[model samples]
Target: MTSKNEITVTGGRLYYEVRGDGPLLLAMGSPMGADAFAPLADALADRFTVVTHDPRGISRSALDDPREDSTPRLRAEDVVAILDDLGAETADVFGSSGGAMTTLALAARHPGRIRTVVAHEPPTLNLLPDAVDRHAEVDEIVKTFETDGLEAAWRMFLSTSGYQEDEAGPPPSDSPEQDLEDGRRFFVHELRETTRYIPDLDALRDGPFRVVVGLGADSGGLLTRRTCAALADELGVPVVEFPGDHGGFIWDPEGFAKLLGDILMTENVRIPLARV
Candidate 1:
């Protein structure tokens, strides 16, 4: 069974859901929100103590410090605060896209807090020499959000992310306009603060922690996959292949969950089984 609750943090109240009954697993979603992780959380709940929460300014989470600024490192600190609040000594963290970037930052900054990290396709453009143009592209995206409006900005972001129209359909628009407004506000802060998130490679390498760089089998040839490959190489580790693409947890929730569970178990995760 999954139970939803809220936790107070530096910013405001952070809504989170806890489920399953095993080793603690912290699933961090993209910068979008924790709702994006629902499917994955449900799937993993059977064998793991799954915990998913809304990041600082997104969803049910409120902003406390107007000056928080939402930088990657600070964002990481928020996650650490969550761990501290929960009284968990360590956890297994899984993050994708922006969340993946945040995971890397967290692992690098709070090495002792996490036992293992599985980051799937972190969009770390700075790591790619050829991706220098992405800075300008993202800058234009931010500008579009400010001027042309949310629809245009969303479309442009998808295009830049290589999701061509007619192929990936429209951006999941339950309320396109409203979504854009919220996204724009949050991303404006995230982009400004996130770009400065440079991982401390030396610290990551020397940190006594196990880091898993995972990529989707279907996400091959994508920039995210490439980034994962590079990160694995830098860390002197192999990039493990997950069940599906960037949104695998949503696309194939059960399969993705099983893959995640297997990986965590292999990485020395111990979940106390309930005995009859």
Candidate 2:
């Protein structure tokens, strides 16, 4: 059974969902929210008490001030609040895209809160050699959103991130209004803060929790694949490959859940290619 709830944070209220019945596992995404992970959470419910949430200022989560920009640190703190609310001392976390950056921050800032972290395709542009250029590109994308509009901004974003229109998949929301709200929050308030976040490599390297950087097997030439490789290299851990591209888990939740279970259950196990 799924239970829906909300908790107050410093400057906002976070909406979250809990389901299933075992050790806690958080399936998270920024701007993606709880609904995006419902399929994967359901697939893993038999073995884990999965939790999913809307990050502050996104979807169901509401911020006190709509103008306040979200940073990785703030989002990390929100995760801590969710754990505290759930009465969980620690949880296994799976964070994708911007959410991956939030998990990395959580591991660094709150050491014992995470048992293991699977960071899938974090857009840690700061870790790349061409970071400055990439950040500038992101700035341009934001500017385009503010000027040219959403569709134009998305086209530029997809092209810059190495995803073709077909490969990037469908829009996150079927409703135009919902899409506009989500896109604005991301491009304006969250994008720069997330991509520009510099992970505390020292803390992650020496922290108590295990950190696993995940790359999509079909994510060749993608910006996030490069970022994931950079993170794995820094952490001295192997990059675990998953099925499909960046949105692999969404595309094939059952197959993705199986692989995730394997990684979480065993230590240093070889990741076999999963066919969705």
Candidate 3:
């Protein structure tokens, strides 16, 4: 059974969904929201109670101020709020892309609330040596959005991120207006903070929770792949290879689910089997 619910957060309401029965596992994304992870959640439902949510100001979640810029710390607090609402002391979390940055923040600030975290291809430019250049590129992308328009900004973003539009295809969107709004939010409010987030290496390295950096086997040239490698190196942990590219979970839900389950079980043996 699947249950959809909403809870009041600091600045707005958070919309989330719960599925299946077992240990708590939160599959989340930043701009991507709960809907993006539905297939993966469904695939893991039999063995885990998967919780997915829309980040504030996105989709079903509503922010009191739409213009409010989202930061990793704020989003991390939101995750803790969700856990508190569910009466879950801790949860295994899977965060993809921008969400991975949020997961890192959660692990750093509230390690007690997480059993394990699988951070897949977080675009943490600050971790890389060429971060200055990359950040400049991001600034240019944002500027492009302000000057040229959405499509031009997106084209630049895709190119800089090493995704070929012809090969990877356009990103999925609900509607043109929604897409435009999301794009604007990402470019103007969320992008810079997310990509430039500096992970607390000491906090994560010494945190009680297990932190696993995941990389896509097919993500050779992608900027996120480099970030994943840098993160793994900093943490002194090997990068766990997943099935496909950055959007692997969306493309191969079954395979992604299986691998994620294995990692959680094998890496978190000390975690009790009882449900949260």
Candidate 4:
């Protein structure tokens, strides 16, 4: 079962959806809207109430100013508003990439309203040793996007992200104008803000909620995986390995959902790779 609703947040109306029934779990991503989590959410619906939504300025969610730059702190506030509207005092949060950065912010700022945070491969470049150089590379990618176009910028972004272009080449040619614009908003505007965000490690270490830094089993020691390890080390926790690379939920929904359920059931039980 699924139900949809909207909430008038500070800058815009936030569109959200609810599926299944039980303990509340919010699954989110920065540029990735609710659509991407459908399969995982569905698989978890039987045992957990799953909530997914588009971050403001993308998909059904509407932001008053599309040009407004989004940051992890601001996106954290958005999650709070969504939870308040849904009458959920607290929830387990599963966030990937940019969403993982937002989850860290939520845990840092409002630990009382969160049960646990399962942060999957947040690209917190600030935590990395070569942050300055990495950020410069990202800046160059943004410059290329501004000077050239989406396709050129995308190529640079993929290459920098450690994604290899196969013999078949990039995934389809030519994204529509709207998609290009969204990419502009994300890469040009949001990417730096999200990656550069330094969470209050002291607060997180002593906070009541459990903070689990996750890494994809097949993600390799790329940018995101390295950052995840850094964060877990800082927090004095183990880096939990999941089913697949960064976007694991999409590829192994059943296994992902079961792992999440196990975590919730055992209150911070680490899901082993063998089980997944």
Candidate 5:
């Protein structure tokens, strides 16, 4: 059973949920929020004490300063705050999309707090060979939101990500205006900082924590998939394929959880962790 709770951190109040019993495992997102990870958390709860939360300034986690930009570094610190509140000295982390970037940053910033991090397709645009063009494209998306609207900007974003409308199945929405508002905040307040983040690879490499970069088996040639592989290469490891595309955990939560458990059981990470 999942239990809900809250904690105040920096400029916001974070709402988080915990379920099951065993080693601590955190499943996270950025603007995607706590609700997005519900199914995945439920699936993994049998093996782990799964925790999920809404990142500050998103959904239930309201920020004191809405205008404060959400940076990867800031989000990473928020994750640490959640851990600190839970009294968990360390946790295995599973971060999807922008959350994956948070996982990397958290591991870099607080090496001893993470046991292993499964980064599922973090779109770190700076790592791409055509980074200049990518940044311009993202800027255009933001501009489209400013001038046209969220739908137009989202269409451009989907198209640029090598996905069409059908692929991005419409989410259940009670209010289109609220959805649009969230999208606007994501693009304006969150996207640029997240995409521009250059990870501290030296820290990740030298730290005691293990980082596992993952992508979906059917992701094929998606931009995020390419970047995922790039990051794995940088970490001197091969990309571990989960069951589906970027949102694989949602598509096949049981399978994803099983794979995640299998990864944690892998011999490479079996050695005792050195305290940071």
Candidate 6:
């Protein structure tokens, strides 16, 4: 169901996997490794040459120099490096969570290298005119990861994210220590630099690449979904609605893959596909 490979990039080596063999769709998972996308990858592989990889510092990707940590621009460049190493001049891309933020950067900074981009729920708090304070709050949470640990940071995060103060309960894995470490070591570096992130929409429009803003049908009014709607309105296109929530690709990978299969295939459909 999966095929694995490796590619060398600046400052590190990437562990990658290929699933299908069509129009080269590159998928980046949330902070978790590409393995999180296993379900979607299998579903799409038959129709497209699907590619997924661990980001620079996670999983099998080796960072030769620990001092190589950096900004989102550097992470976006890693995506570009992966494509180049695979001999792909350009490809369609789908990025979620922090990965979605990375996708926007790629489109804005390297427009000529992407055919199309779908950025789902990028969590661009800096984009919302009313959400600037929320950005600062999350930044503090990132700081907590440095001072406190993952559990405290996550508790604060879930509480702020409408997790309903123990109403929804803790993650099944519930390893606060592990979470704290991951946040301090990996997320703090990636997310803190990403907080005030806002993409140049003007540049996105002028670029040749087609853009689709995704909102999870189940996510409702979450900041990321609203942000997607705002962007779709600005771009003069219908919001591309998909199944599931912020982490839909992981929660409902089978259904998510089916939805994605349609999105990637029905680009030319007459009726704007609507999800109820």
Highest lDDT, which number?
2
| Highest TM-score against the true fold, candidate | 2
lDDT of predicted model 6: 0.73
How good is model 2 by TM-score? 0.96
All candidates' lDDT scores?
0.74, 0.89, 0.88, 0.84, 0.83, 0.73
By lDDT, is 2 or 4 better?
A: 2
Alpha-carbon lDDT of model 2? 0.89
TM-score between candidate 6 and the true structure: 0.87
Instruction: Give the TM-score comparing model 1 with the true structure, all chains together.
Output: 0.89
| Candidate 2 residue lDDT tens string, 122-149 | 9989889999999999999999999999
lDDT of 1 by residue, 21-53 (tens): 899999986565667787888888878898888
RMSD of 3: 4.6
Where in model 5 is the C-alpha error above 4 Å?
A: 175-177, 268-276
Query: In model 1, what are the clashing residue pairs, if there are any?
Result: 11-64
Query: Which regions of candidate 6 deviate over 4 angstroms?
Result: 67-70, 166-181, 270-276
Worst 10 residues of 4 by lDDT: 166-175
Alpha-carbon shift of residue 121 in model 5 (angstroms): 0.3
Model 4 clash tally, residue pairs: 0
Per-residue C-alpha lDDT of model 5 across residues 204-231, encoded as one tens digit per residue: 8888987888888767757887788678
Best-to-worst order by lDDT is 2, 3, 4, 5, 1, 6
Clashing pairs in 2: none
Q: What is the lDDT of candidate 1?
A: 0.74
Worst 10 residues of 6 by lDDT: 167-176
Q: Candidate 6 on 47-121: residue-level lDDT in tens?
A: 888889887776567678754554557778988888887898999999887777788889999998898888777
Q: What is residue 180's positional error in candidate 3, in angstroms? A: 1.6
